[model samples]
Target chain A: MKKLVLRLRDLPPSAWIFFAWLVTLSVLPFLIILAMSFAVRSESGLISWTFTLANYERAFHLVYLKVLAKTIFLSLGATITCLLVGFPVAYYLARATPEKRQMGLMLLFIPFWTNFILRIYGIVSIFGNHGLLNQTIMRLGLTDSPIEILYTRFGIYLGLVYNYLPFLVVPIFSALEKFDLSLREAAMDLGANRWQTFTRVLLPNVREGIAIGSLFVFIPMMGEYVIPDILGGAKEVFLGRVMVEQFFTMQDWPFGSALASVLSMGLMIAVWVRMRFEQRKAGPTSHGLR
Target chain B: MGDQRILKVLLNGMLAIILIGGAGFWFARKSNDSAQPVLRICAWSNYLPQNVLTQFQKQTGIRVELSFVSSNEELFAKLKAGATGFDLIQPSDYMSRQMIRLGMLRELDHGQLKNLGNLMEDVRSPAWDPGLKYTVPFSWGTTGLVINTAKVPLSPGEIPGWGMLFESPDPKRTSLLDDMREVFSAMLIWKGSTPNERNHQKLEETLAGLRNIRENILMFTSEPRQYLARSELNISHAYSMDALQAAEMKPEFKYFIPREGAVRWADNFAIPTSAKHVAEAYRFLDFILDAKVASELALKGHFSTQNQPAWDLLPEAEKNNPVLYPDQATKARLYYLEDLGDLLVLMNRMWAELKI
Candidate 1:
């Protein structure tokens, strides 16, 4: 038994176990969904596994394709907005005195410890037509009418920024913490101006952080149903709402699965491209750091 | 090496606790929970008031745990999974018949229900389950056009028909129900056929008529309250209860039963054969059947009273309201939605094709 244990320990602790677990849980669910996309749905709402590309063909119609494109566009817009808002805040937090920084970091995390649904309700209470913001604006005589804000794309953007800001902040904060401060100081000392030092030294160092943050935001923003459903009303149509309509209201499971698989594929391609870019940036550093 | 070993041990301990604690607590809760008797109710999120459950608990000392299912398909899927986790379920009349045929329903002991006689004559002997053998009627409402009278023309004593919608002066300004059964039935009635038509040619004709009115429809929606509150569109075909609820919120909003007649449906509470809290479930049903409780529900919401005594007991303010209790002639022009069986599936497919 000792000999067997020694042999097992000597094998470099194979990562095959983790790979198997991932395949069983994550990859299998995706494959099942992909398989379901090609199945046929009967009038009785029964799904039959008679291989067909009809669902995909049906999905290619102009209305759905336009909605898919719009979803991608919304996700891209949200990801960029998060990075722009989060970068300075993260940098400020990372560079603060250690004592104060802990408190700021804790403040950022305190809201997350509460239920996600409750946090969303908090946003609604603030921005609803009869809510505080509208009441305040109307009281101040900014305009005669309450602004049509909550159910528009503006509302969707506000919701997206509120929910996903922390994801962007956390990773950038970690990257900033591990950042080599000497590189920036040395550049500034050697006649590089503040902007020059920041652009040349700080930006390149945080590429990984931006990629990680964008991936976190972009992937989820694609499948985000609740935020849009609550905030967008019927004015804007996202891919998530379309898929839900197919499954629940329309009773077309195969078509819904097809839409889900298409969304998954889009997200996978995005993550893959981001990883490749990261690898290119990290080419020499992993070995040099070691 | 010693420091590395210590760090490794600490990480492993944390990981072990996270995984095992989560799984163990879940498993322990599942098992420990199995021993306690729960009257599992599968229904909409807020179909029944919370007071009903608490009162039943007070009287019977049994806890009722509710599991919400959002749609008909979801309810069926849970039942099909052989999850006996539910003791009582609320399904519409069409689905109640299907569940009964599938042997998922338990034959109720009518002797347990003293208020069974209080149910209206029409709801008691439904065509779906004749003589109310396996189901207990709860709430019912008709599907009709709810018009904003401030916007739509209202001639003296001239009732609007389905033609106001299908042949609307402005097609782009109308709205319709998103439900297949209700929409298709409305279309059928518009085309001068019986609402329960099995004829394929008649179904196609109905679909074509729906297509004509499609452009006029601003949008199809289930939450009519949201749209009505905004006064987004002037006309909407909706459940009478939903319309009444919205009208109460916005007084200018008015609900009318169309001249071609509309579909009415009843939602029922039934005991599943696999129930563990049959006694408590019955007790809960009986509590809601009480005149005061039923009246309170009807007065507060858009609910039409099935209890005649409760309807009479309500104050004059409520009793005079036509939305809650329509006149005899308006009631005569409405048809209760019967189980169309295979014809429903056919109608659903037809509606899908038209939308495409």
Candidate 2:
């Protein structure tokens, strides 16, 4: 035990410091939120600490359950959309000549320089009733009336894809950069077709990236408010909007907090399952390395 | 090894202190007074004239802070996050009642408000807060249609009514406010059920009428001023203030309270129960109620004044604007929103259903 203490004492200062701070700052909030999940709200819209399972039970009601299910479904659709659209672009950027790769990556990042709300607002200017898109279509004699594209489910879907595609692209691009060309070449050299090489060699190699990107888009999409709020008009009602109405219009904090806690638990379970899967996959290779 | 270990231990201890101390200080500083008491006033972005705030700061020692929220929902979130330390808040009539029911508002002493008498007699002792118990009436406006005479010219003496919004051949040619209550109330009025009616059949009829309007609406927006100014819309079911704002920007724009009547709303100022500087909040409220300040607010925000004396202070050109002061008959037809209680849940759900 003395030797163990001495050895630990011999370790670098920065590493110890980083670990301590990470635990206190990053980990503490989640614990607080978890603890808060058990609490209840008073008539004053303020939360009170009383250990009760009522909030969780209330969260399971049909209205909220349906909302949660819809949120998950929407997130799944967004994730799949990002993957289908992002993977090829990521691949193209990764395999491009060195000079072109920088430009492609810059194009992905340029949108980030603007305020997010402004970008969403910019969509209105382009798609509003007398907006340029409709004006152009009219000038070209495509139709007599302006196309109704501003306040529909399709508009919301388009906005989500436009906003989150970068998140998916950046990660997969990073993964593809470190991808070993020889693995794909070896598969091809051994009579494997392009599709076989991609599935067997490329997919496994970039699994971490895909997982990271999915988590990035999926988690936020579940709690997404602004995109749907602006583009969806009244057509697409999501969980976030429902939560806002509950808290503000209905003045039901207990119910809103309950809904929030359930959503948090759902997200935590999703992350834990993903991490467990990744850990299981890593175990055999880590043992081989040892 | 022993000497190296001691050195490393010393370094580790120092590191731990730095990490823990930094976080502790960060949180401490966050809680600590930044020497500026942030007074978060949740109102429309263009509602409060900055000049008035600056004048208030000069008169008093307190630094005024402001946050603009497009909807009451956003404002509600800030109020719920108690750590935000907002001293004052502005909410609409029904929202004020909801907040008061939830005990979010501080019980105001009318004695502190010197300009309380400056408010119109009718606006005082409102049903929501009888005898000015919790909130001070800030700015009032009626929800109605703003017509662009250039696109859909009114006949020689014709004014645009609510029916004009639905009667156009192209259903996707008009605009409406995105607010559920306003949109729903307008539909209720059009259906001939009183906006305050609690009957189930009335609600269903209103809901059905709204569904049709929803189909007809090109897009619903909170900021109708933008749509009107750009001519993005021919006619919009808009707040009187927003219509006045559009008229100021473009003279061709004309605003009218529809023949079916419209919902009148008053955005009010109140100190929250958690206000640290209640005196300053009261002073601020009273300052806005002053005749000069009221007129200045009218000029800036383009909302009508409830302070009757402020109307005389304005120039004849400004006073003559019908949107600023609709005639007696128009005023009689309008209704202000009152608390709906549990029925709000049904209304909200119906709105969601319509959107879907």
Candidate 3:
């Protein structure tokens, strides 16, 4: 025990300090949330000291399960949409001259610098029933009636895609920027066509970047309450909204914590799956290269 | 080395400075702790004017510290989090009742509040707090509909009651309050049932009705005034104060309590059981209850005051504004929300189902 203490003290101060801070800030709060999830709520909505699995039992009910499924579906849709729309933009920016590339990246990040809620409100105004789209259409004699765009599934998709497109673009762009040009040349030299060479060479190289970008987009979208609340008109319930209602409106902290715990577990499983897939794909390729 | 000696000297100087500063801070805090009475108030933002607070501080040497909460649930949560140093808190009628039941509030000494009689008779002994034992009514308002006259040109007679919301020619332009109780109550009132109806069959009927109208609703939001102002939403279920504010921005807008009736709410001032400066809290409550001060606060907040003398002092235009002071028939129609206790779970479930 004395030797262990002395050895721990001998370690670099910065390393131990950072480890302590991480444990305190992140791990401690998570542990507390886990503990709270097992507790019971009193008649007046206060958390009781007694432990129970009733909160978790209630969380897995059919209604809540449906909400969770919808949340996952929405997030997946957003992630795929972002990847599709972001790839071409990222490709163009990556292939641009350094000066042009910097400008393109700046333009991409400019929208993000603005307040998120303000940007959402701006979207609301643009897609609203008597919004700019309908007004423009009317002025151009295209249609007499205003086009209904806001407060629909389409509106939510637009908001999610617009908000998360940059997350996908930035990571994929960086990956493309680091790509070895010789690999593409070699694929072509081996009698591969443009499409074939691109598929065989370019796609695999950027798989990690795509995975990282998809995770960045998907995780936050799964817990998104604001965009759906503002843009989708609170017509549907999502996991984030359900959790918020439980915590704030219902004042049921244990149930909210249980919902949050399940969500975190789902997220962990998703991350693990992705990591395993990446490892399996990388293993054979790395060995072949060596 | 000379550099090593300089570094040691610098470290000693820094240590001395920190120790001295820490001592000074501790001494200052200790001195201030006993110097003056500090009254901590937790309430909704803009509920009390800064000038009124300043006046109270000047008159009584008590320093006032204010914290704001957007909702009553937040107030309850703050107290439940080990009774934060809140000498006074503002809770709506139903919430006050819940807090009282939970033994979270301190019963008021009516003798300490000299101006208690200034309150209107109706609110003097409200159902939530009979005999004004736990709370004093601060501000009151009704939850109703705000219509953009430009888009919704129909006369009041043409579109009467909550039915107008569901049966509108352009239902796509209508919005409902995002609040669960308010939305459910609106639907109930439209069905010619009491807003607080608890029958399972009736609730199911209400849920079906909401689902039917779901496609027609433009959105559910608390702050639909912006949408209403922009003509994005033609009609919305909103609070009378918010509706009036929206109408002030656009003269064409109108606020009307549907013929069927609506939720009449009153926010109240109460002292928590954990309050330390009960005397200061009483003084502050009494100061705000003064007829002139009450009138000023009412005008600034743009909500009705239960102070009868304050009502008498209002301008004829404000006094005659039907939206601010509804006629007797409308008043008869208005209902107060009761604390449903365990039954709230039912309401929450129905609310979730409605949104889903």
Candidate 4:
């Protein structure tokens, strides 16, 4: 016991405090939710102590499954779009002079200075049925009628991409900043074209950034409620919205907990699969680079 | 060796400061826990006027903390999650009844409430809470249509019932309430049935009717006032107060209870069973019921007061505002939503499907 105490004391105090805080705030609540997922709901919408699998069974219904599928599809679409749009901007910022890069980065972060909901509302005012976009188009004689832009699937996708674009760009930009440009020069000297150099050398070096950026966008987009609720006009259902309704509106705590548990498990599996795939793809070449 | 000793002393001093600060916080919290009576109220946003709350606080010498909820279900969930510090809660009539049934409300002592006689004869014995045992009526309004007159250009007489909304030529120009109960009730009333139609067949018929016109709807939203003001939506199902408030801002808008029928909703103040400041809660209830205070709150909120003297105090213009005080024939058609019990789940499922 004396040795154990001495060993614990040898570690930095900050690390000990951080570990304690994480366990208390994150781990404990997650464990409690996991425990509640197996509980039963009483007639009056209260959680009962008796253990049951009914909540999990209810979570597997066709409607919930469909919602989960739709959410995944939307998340995947948003992530892919972010990656495609963010890559060029990140590359340019990385290659720019220091002052120019700093200005561009400041511009990127300026949107975040405002409240998130306020930003979404700004988008609404711009793209609403009687919004600036339609007014401009009509005045320009572009069309005879107003275009339906807000409260559509396209609108939801646009909002998600706009909000999360910075997350993707910042990571890729930082990764490119640390990238060894000599590798690209070597590929070109070896008679490889620009595309080949990019694919073979540049892509592999910044694969970590791509993975992280995808994760930053994908995970939050999966659980996104406000964007779809406001922009989608409650026309379509999303998994996060359903889970929230279960907890707040329906007051089915057991079912909500069960849904949340399943979603977390699914996200974990997805992340694990992605890591394994990236590892396998990077195996031989990554070894040579190291 | 000297530097190490200094570091040790600095760390010990930091630890001492933290300990002292934590002790101070604990002691302060303990002292505050017993110092003053605080009346914690949870109600819908803008339900109680700020002036009324301030007056109550001044008179009673008690601090009042206010929290707002968007829906009764949210309030219920908060109470269920052991939000026991709340001394007063404002729930709709049906929700109050439901809370009373669930043993979540404190029975009111009528003897302590001197202004109980101020309540109008009709509201005194509401069907939901006969004799007002557990709740007191705060404000009442009807769920109705708010139209952008500049866009739709139809008078109240020309545009008749729910059919004007359901069979709208341009369904994309109309919006409906997002609430399941309100939407379902509207459908039931449109189909010439009661809002509280409990029969499964009648509900199924209403669901089918809603499905037929579902595509016409622009959206189901709780806040259609903004859309109506912008003329993005020409017609919307809305509460009378919201409609009136929106119309006050944009004169192009007008609110009307459909000639067919509409849902009449009453919000009530009730004490929770776990209330800590019961005396303050009672005082607040009586204070708000005063004729002048009730009149002020009603005028500000743009909802009808249940106090007869308060009604009398209303200006002729406000008294004649059909939206606030509908005619007797319109009042005859208004129905309050009842607690649906087990069928609520079914209704929720049906509403979800309709949205999908």
Candidate 5:
């Protein structure tokens, strides 16, 4: 036993620390949730230990399917908007002088200093009927009545895109900064047009950065309730809202777990596909030396 | 090299101890708060007046701490998830019933509550708690309508019933509650059905009615006070406290219980089974039960007091406000929401469908 202790002490502390985190933070909790998804909810709305497939059965209803489809559509719309807006911002930021880059980066991160919910609430006041925007519009005589922007799907899209634009920008910016300037010249020297150079060479190189950044925003977006709840005026039922209602309003823990498990499984499959794509891109050369 | 490594390890060990000791000292300062008992109560936001809490602390020499919840379901979620630190919790009528049925509440010791006689006789035995066994009624309110008369083009006397909600000149300027039970109760009352509706056929009709109004409603929000203040919402389905307080502040916005009637909910104080400071909890309860404190609470919160003595202490102008203390005819229209038992699943399912 003493030798075992001494051997354990001899091993690197970081390795054991990471192992501890893996078990406590990720693996154990996931296993528990997976087990709970199959559990039964008593008539009292509390969980019982008995196993049942009723939660999954209920989760597969048309209502949940509609919610899932809406959530995916909203998230996809936000991600696409982020990409369109982020590319130009990232290019300017990456190509700027040191001081300008620093200032630009500072501007990008300033919104993050405040609480996420507080920032969303700030959006509410700006777009609300009695808000600054509407007041300005009326003064300018843009229209007779206030344009109804608040509590609409358009407002939710603006919020999701606004919050996540920086996340997508930073990564693509880093990739652009590392890009070789002469590559464009080389492509031009080989008679490639500007559009071809951008599409063929630049985009392919930055696609990884884009994928990683999109996933960073997309995963969290799938679980977002506050932005839609506040900015969307608690209308347009999303998956996260349904999941929360299951636990709090409905008091159905088993059903909530079942919904969560399905979402997590979908996310894991996405991550697995990403990893496989990267592995195929890397090919077998890296392992040949071993 | 070995000697150097040992010296480094010793230095790090001392640093770790100092860091941990600092954290311990910081926490110990909070735990070492004198010999005075600490009473913790979790209640709805703005329910417990600061002055009352201060007076109780001064009289009993017990320190008080407070946490707040926005809804009864939130309170239930917290306690049911193994939150045991609170000595007392405030639950609404239906939630109190649900908790009592589940044996999650501690029975009241009538001997400790000396000021119990201050409560109205009618509230002495509610349907949820027979013989005042588990809960003490705090305040009663009605889910009613608040209309901005300046924009709505209607006099306070001319305000129609629930029909005005759907049939308003600009229904787009209105909002309904995000709460399933409240919205459903409003619809049930409008359709001349019981609030805690169980018949699936009637509920189906109610669901269809909600879907029709779903387009008319600008949004679904439990808290519409901010919107009403900004005149963003001309007509809103609001709680009595929010509407009454807004009416008092802005006379242009009139609040009234619709003739179609509405859901009447009461907040109550009940000790959880996991209470640690039971004696201190009783002392705090008796303090609030005092007629003087109860009247102050009602006056400040804009909710109707359950204490009869408190009602007597109120000003004549307030005592006669039909909105606050409704006339017998209006009172006859109010319905109390109860635990719907197994039918809650159906209620939630229908609510989800309506949202979709």
Candidate 6:
């Protein structure tokens, strides 16, 4: 027993503890869920020990595939929109004086201080029927009536972009701030047009920040639950809600576990591939600000 | 060097033992918390008022711990997941039947409930739990349409049915209950069947109807009060508890049971097999069964009480409210959503397909 204790002590004690914690709390639970994904759902809504590939097979059905496609489509659409909407704001922030930049950032972060649901309520007030948007449109005589927005696909897309806009902006702003502005000036001095300078020098300089920011938004929007349910009026089904529905409403833990694992597996692969691409982009000498 | 190594080993061994012993002691204390009998209850939110809890504690000296689940399905899933230490749980009619079948509920000692005689005749020997063997009815309600009259034009004398809600002028302004049973019950009854629909032919027909209606409805949600408050929804499928609350808040909102009828359910109090404080749970049950207490709770909590004496104590205006206390003819038309057991699996599949 003393020898065994001595052998155990030979390993760094803190390292052993951390390893144990990670395995118990993270790895073990994930493995259990993976196992459950392979199991069957019983009639009583409990996990049946029978092994089956039926859950995975059912996931591949056309109906479920449509859900998957919609999930990806919405997330990608939101990400792209965020980049377009956020880049200009980030540039302005980066170019602003230090005092103004601080205030701009403060305003951007104010919404975050409030609860997420409350911010969603604020969004609803602005977009609902007879909401501020409609009231203004009516006052201005823009149209005959209120425009339907919240219960449409466009609404979910806008919600995703709206919630993640700040995260996307901060990273791009940082990159632009750290960017040596002389690069832009040098390109223009060499007979480059404004668009040429922007596309060639400025954009390339901030590629790392832009990529990181896009990822920050993309990953969360992929699994977003509340924003769509609240602002989008839950007119559509998404992966996160589907998983929750299976677990809580349907009481089908095995199927919910299967759905979750599929999502997690896809996310892991996507993130891994992105990391690999970034590594190659950054090989040898690091490009862009340190 | 060898002696120093032995000393180091001894020091480490002693430390490990002390840590293990301390952890064990902490767990021991957690399990046996206090001298005061503690009863843990898992019920729907707002069903157990703070004042009721305080009053029960004051009268019986039993400490109460409360938790909430949004739906009966969620409550079932929690118990199935081996969540223990719940002395009492509030499950609706169908859910109580399911729990009884699964042997998850403990048989109630009616003798301990001195106020059992005070319960309404309708619930005393409910179809779900005959003779009140495994459950005691707490609050009962019906599922129906709650309309915002300012948006949807209708006279108080001219009653609207499910057909009107389905064929609503503005489909985008209508909301259905997100619950499978609630949604399917309304759909089934509207399609000329009972709420506890069983015929596969009819079930398939209902499924198709649900799919068609899914696209036209604004959204499906268990909670539609927020939308009604914002005037975002014209028609919503609602429980009496929520509809009444919404009506009270906004005079424009009115609860209406369709002419084709709707589902009725009773949320009941039942002890789980995991209960540790059985005696305390019984005490709390009897306190809730008390006529005056039940009456006060029914009024304050916005739920229709199943205790006749307690309900009798309510003001005539409240008693006469059509939505709360419908006429005997309307009561006869109401159907209970039953525990379909294996058929629930099929219902879940149908819901999944419809949502997709």
Give all candidate RMSDs, comma-separated.
Answer: 6.8, 5.4, 3.9, 3.6, 3.8, 5.0
Cα deviation of B52, candidate 2, in Å: 3.8
Winner on TM-score between 5 and 6 is: 5
The CA lDDT of each predicted structure is 0.76, 0.77, 0.85, 0.85, 0.85, 0.84
- Indicate whether candidate 2 or candidate 3 has the larger lDDT: 3
Give the Å error, residue A102, model 2: 3.2
- Write down the lDDT that model 5 would get: 0.85
Model 3 misplacement above 4 A: A1-18, A287-290, B1-39, B61-65, B82-85, B156-159, B327-329
The number of clashing residue pairs in model 1 is 2
**CAPRI grade of model 1:** incorrect
Model 5 is docked with a DockQ of: 0.48
The true-versus-predicted C-alpha distance at residue B296 of model 6, in Å, is 2.8
Steric clash pairs (candidate 6)? none
User: Which model scores highest in TM-score?
Assistant: 5
lDDT of 1 by residue, A183-226 (tens): 88888888889988777778878767877887888888888877
Off by over 4 Å in 4: A1-11, A277-284, A287-290, B1-38, B57-63, B194-215, B320-322, B327-329
lDDT of 2 by residue, B71-151 (tens): 665677677776356778888887787788888899988889888899888889877788889998877788988888887
Which pairs clash inside model 1? B171-B216, B172-B216
Clashing pairs in 4: none
Model 3 per-residue lDDT at B159: 35
Model 5 chain A scores worst on lDDT over the 10 consecutive residues at: A281-290
Instruction: Give lDDT tens digits, candidate 3, residues B1-356.
Output: 55555656766887999999999999997798699888999988767778888898999988999989877887888788786689999999889888988899999999999998999988888888899899999899999888887777866555356876787666888889988888889989888888789788998899899989998888899888888877778888898878887887788888888888999999999999999889999999999999999998888787898999988998888888877898898899899886566777667667777766
Name the lDDT value of residue B30 in candidate 6. Answer: 82
True contacts kept of each: 0.04, 0.33, 0.57, 0.43, 0.56, 0.50
Off by over 4 Å in 6: A1-26, A140-144, A276-290, B1-37, B170-172, B198-208, B211-216, B320-322, B325-329, B340-356
Residue B286 in candidate 2 has what lDDT?
84
Q: Listing candidates in order, what is each one's chain A TM-score? A: 0.88, 0.85, 0.91, 0.93, 0.91, 0.87
Give the count of colliding residue pairs in each prediction: 2, 1, 0, 0, 0, 0
Per-residue alpha-carbon lDDT of candidate 6 for residues A30-54, written as tens digits (9 for 90 to 100): 8998999999987656788999987
